[model samples]
Target chain A: MNPRKNGILCLLLVLMCGVLVLSGCGGGGAATPPATPPAGGSDEPAAGEPINVGLNLELTGSSAEFGLSGQNGMKLAFDKVNAEGGVLDGRMFNYIPADNKSEAGEATSATTRLVGENVVAILGPMTTAAVLGSIQLVTDNNIVLITPSGTNARLTVNEDGTLNPWIFRACFIDPFQGEVAANFAMDVLGAETAAIAYDIVGDYSGGLAASFKQTFEAAGKTVVREEQFSAGDTDFRPIIENIKTAGPDVIFVPAYYTDDGRFVLQARDAEVTVPILGGDGWGSGDMVGIAGAENMNNTFYVDFVYMDDPSLQDFVSEYQAAYNRAPDGFSVLGYESAMMLVEAVKNAGGTDPEALRSALENLGEFTGISGTMTFDPETHNPAKTAVILESVDGVKEFKQIVEPK
Target chain B: MRWTKYLIWLAAAGAFYALTLALSGAGFISRFMLMTMVQICIYIIMALGLNLITGFTGQLSIGHAGFMSIGAYAAGFLASTYGGRVSAALTEALGGAGGAAVYYIFILATLAAGAFVAAAFGVLLGLPTLRLRGDYLAIATIGFGEIVRIVLLNTKALGASSGLPVKNSVGWTTAYWLMLLSVVLIYNFVNSSHGRACISIRENEIAAETMGINTTKYKVMAFALGAGLAGLAGGIYANHMYLIHPNSFNFLKSFEILVMVVLGGLGSITGCILGAVVMTVMNNALSAFPEMRMIVISVLLVVMMIFRPNGLMGTTELRLPFRRKAAGGKEDVTHGL
Candidate 1:
């Protein structure tokens, strides 16, 4: 080889070495689809191996706490299943979790890599935007996507009045929660005028805001102002300054815990003393820590059933015993989602996703930790009541459960 | 010899295109893979352009992606609104060849707009900072890239904070072809006479000036040309996904493109392509194991810097073995096609 050729060969050699090593470490064990009957079926494994499940959660970055909590919750279920001698004929379940870092693009990237790994089923992504990016990939691959927390209403609905069978959520969609807040604002608080502020960049926040707006307007409440902010925006002073002039009875902020919590504090700091309303993104205890107790006072939001509910003392103890921490809304949803998957597997009498999906479609009157649930065929969303909670003393205390209309 | 190289090039190109087409149809090609490959192509194009400046003409650029953002948004607005209309009009205007003409027009406009916008940005950013060298130029370019991203992030007309959604009508075939054609044109251009001129500037700017090479003209030309390519990549990318989120084209993205150039060796076009592909594959494959990904890329970069800092395939083209019948002397000079 000529000297120039040697130089080029060396460069190619270096890159190829990296490529070879990276590619070699890339392959993981194949997922074994579960073999047991569906939830209502006989207790016998009817088929092959357990399924490989993929999860893309924001285990780091802005939503790290939520992601970690959800993963732990899912892990609890995985442990229980494996300990009991696995799902579907002793075929063990494999759960792989990838961190999305709370970015939609990263979440999608993670989902792609997971698909390459050939996971049979996916249980994620925590954020709605993340879910949106992953849905096409999952659906195109004919794999089932069971998002434990994604609540955007559009996920379930197509342009036509049919269901997106490939996609299912263990958690409640935004419309119900948004409506619950709307009712609380109009009927409970008797607030005639409400101003809405939410992070425009997020599909989750924006979708929930739309629901709240639609519900509030239907109830004949006058909405004074609608303001938007971007994610990673620290200063809410500008939005707050604008909101102060609007002077609504209450300001609805359907945003993530980080932004919403800080925004709440900023609103108070700016002397815009009106009560703040929010959605499920305000569920975590971390919000109080991030925004301070004084900032979060008088702020109310809708969320999943309380983790510390006395009625579910046994469940709470089991969760705490398993995870060594008190559960949050994500924990419940994660646990319930795993259980829901198990139920479908049992009902189908096999680990086959197609059969499980069929069973899921026909699923009725199933009770879980979240609440009793039913999945309508047209929209894969499960029906459940939204619980309104006030951030009293910087802690979420359940006010009332608004049953589905 | 030229024929043989062309034949080899054609075969390789065919294989690559076919492979991409097949991969695009694979059930496992998730959103991440699709987007990553798209982004990698964008970076490769941008790096190739910047290579002409910094690598080939000895002028550094840290704001390559900024020019890309401009091209992206510009072509994005056109493709989202006008691509179809123009296609319709061209079909009517050019009789049976209207669709083809519209496509050509779209490509031409996108490339032209990208070049025009990038040249403007290059001039705006370069004019003030031309006197700077090395670290200073890098800092200025990096600052300019950040400013571009921030401006895009804040601008309401550019979809505000949410960033724009890709109009969602992109065909995979069109994207793949665009990338392929770009690589070929760039490869050819880099190996041409002008390419030698650019390389001469890189080797000794003062010497080239002493030889009446008009160094400033070449430097400016290199920056403008590089900016144009970056713009073209951005435009295609914007149309490819039908989305333009400003954050996606930030300083970090600029650095990633720079990494492609640096990792590939300064003046090596072949190195850049290989590096782009390697980086793209690594990003898609290692994302599953997130912790390992950062460590892996970091170690790879470190090892490359230590062992083969010039890059993989630096200034070398891949060639097949052949014979000169009469002489019988072994000769394997790989010419970049």
Candidate 2:
């Protein structure tokens, strides 16, 4: 062997060892070991072992903001519960959070790791795509999974309307939300016709648009026009002009904040002045800045809960102080999911998977920060009211809560 | 001597298989790690295929993932439609003995179907665009990838954007063996006379053509073969993951495979394998630290490129220590022993 080549190989070997050691130390330093159960007081039963709850979230990719906010909310809720003498007769709730990187393969790997940690239940991977990717593992393991904001109708139920046994969600399904928005459009706004502009490439927007079209047309109102644009599309004048010519009473834009805000601004610029409604995808704070406050006036959207609700003032203040930002829909839903899981653990009398699952299935009207949520045994979907909020000068003001009948 | 070499290879492979099985059974290797191992194997097959096309044939393909997606969707669809029936029939025919055997056979059939469909697509894509070279060929390939993704996203029969799920799970053991076979086959092809002709074209296309070598036929053949192997990897991946989505095979995936090939030393088969293993492990390891994963990966890539611009192996192959020398007796110093 050449001495120089051997020297280079040795250098590479040392470098590789250095990297392994650094990564090992970094992982140890970052992941704080789960805390032991606290010493019990007279009223509390002897503190049992902590219950492990897994969180698979998109903490670093395109949807990192949503996952980060949810993580904060879950942390706040867990802290509050532990501080007030933890659940299941003073058993602490230990969180095992894994970042899925907002990719399908990563989601499965994250879920697999979480399951390997022996979690009693799992929460989140936020988006529908991430949930679909890993739901098989969760089901195969028979671990209870409560997603905070995966609203695709298929997540909870199969195409044939059979339940996915181990799956449950805190947010309303897309079809239900779409139906509520459509009802509000026809019955409340007295609109005779509706127009929809949605991103063709995204499942959320496309699904919502399809549902809204079905419901609105079912209500005997004409779907005047349906225009499609892909994500990252800038110009909406051509679509807005087509909608304007159709002259619908309202326009539904079921897209995320970035594209939704742009569409609103462009539609207003083109002088097509009809109320632009959307789904929860318009809940981000950046929406106001993207479409100026004035331009966003009179716009409405459906959400899990209205941020300005008087009932949630205490939670709102605590969350704002803790995170230095108001909790969005994802945050509140995350808090609700943790609260629901803890409550089920308490009701089940232990952290046994089967017991906790039964408790969740039989859970009745539990008052959450979002709303009174009750999981339907058949669909595992929470039967809760949807909130309608009107954006007034960039501020989301509470309008009405439409109940599911 | 040749028989001895073959025996040694078989023994080594068997030992590796036994070791992995023991580790997995004893719970020394976690499921996550096993999944990562399967992912590395899949990437190895993909990088090897891409290396044959881009590194040896001198045709840059930015759309290898398209063929992979085709293979995955085709295999997933077949598994969904026929997997259960085939399993039941085999079980009934062979009774208790066929329980696991049926599954292995079904997986093999699914993989073959995936490869065949993908190779057909390769021929379809290559016949038109193989005439173009360089950036034009790259652009055409990119278009092919996007077209596959968009078409799958809109096709209801293929489950649209939601993706199709294969009910029968292919364990890591089966996937590992299949991937190993693919790598061996690709290695053998790259060392054959056809491979030499492909390399000649890469060296100087006009010279090879003027020498009466059919550059067009070899180029198409190499492209189709690479694509077929990639399809086989994709089928294995789909079943191993139990899910196949259009987004999984987007341009980023192709870029990742290309990175492995380039970073491994493009023309070296052993380099592709080493590159795939290192990149996959690094990716899985860094994922533990979500905030700094991409940053660390980028910095490492930059450092690697700065140190060895031609890649880690730089066209050198790794060979068994006891392998015989070439006929000229000059000693093959290109092997990184």
Every model's TM-score = 0.78, 0.93
State the TM-score of candidate 1 restricted to chain B.
0.82
Best by lDDT: 2
Q: Cα lDDT of model 1 overall? A: 0.73
**Top candidate, metric TM-score:** 2
Question: Where is model 2 more than 4 Å wrong at Cα?
Answer: A1-11, A14-47, B92-100, B324-337
* DockQ of predictions, in order shown: 0.28, 0.42
Which consecutive 10 residues in model 1 chain B have the weakest lDDT in total?
Answer: B325-334
Per-residue lDDT tens digits of candidate 1, residues B1-337? 6677568767987898788767767744544456677767766777788777777777777788898888888777666567667777777878767667567767657656765787777766666776676788888888888888878866777664445544444444556666677677666666666666777887887787788887666666677778878887887776655346676677767887878888776777766777787777776566556668778888988987886777766655543344334224643222533
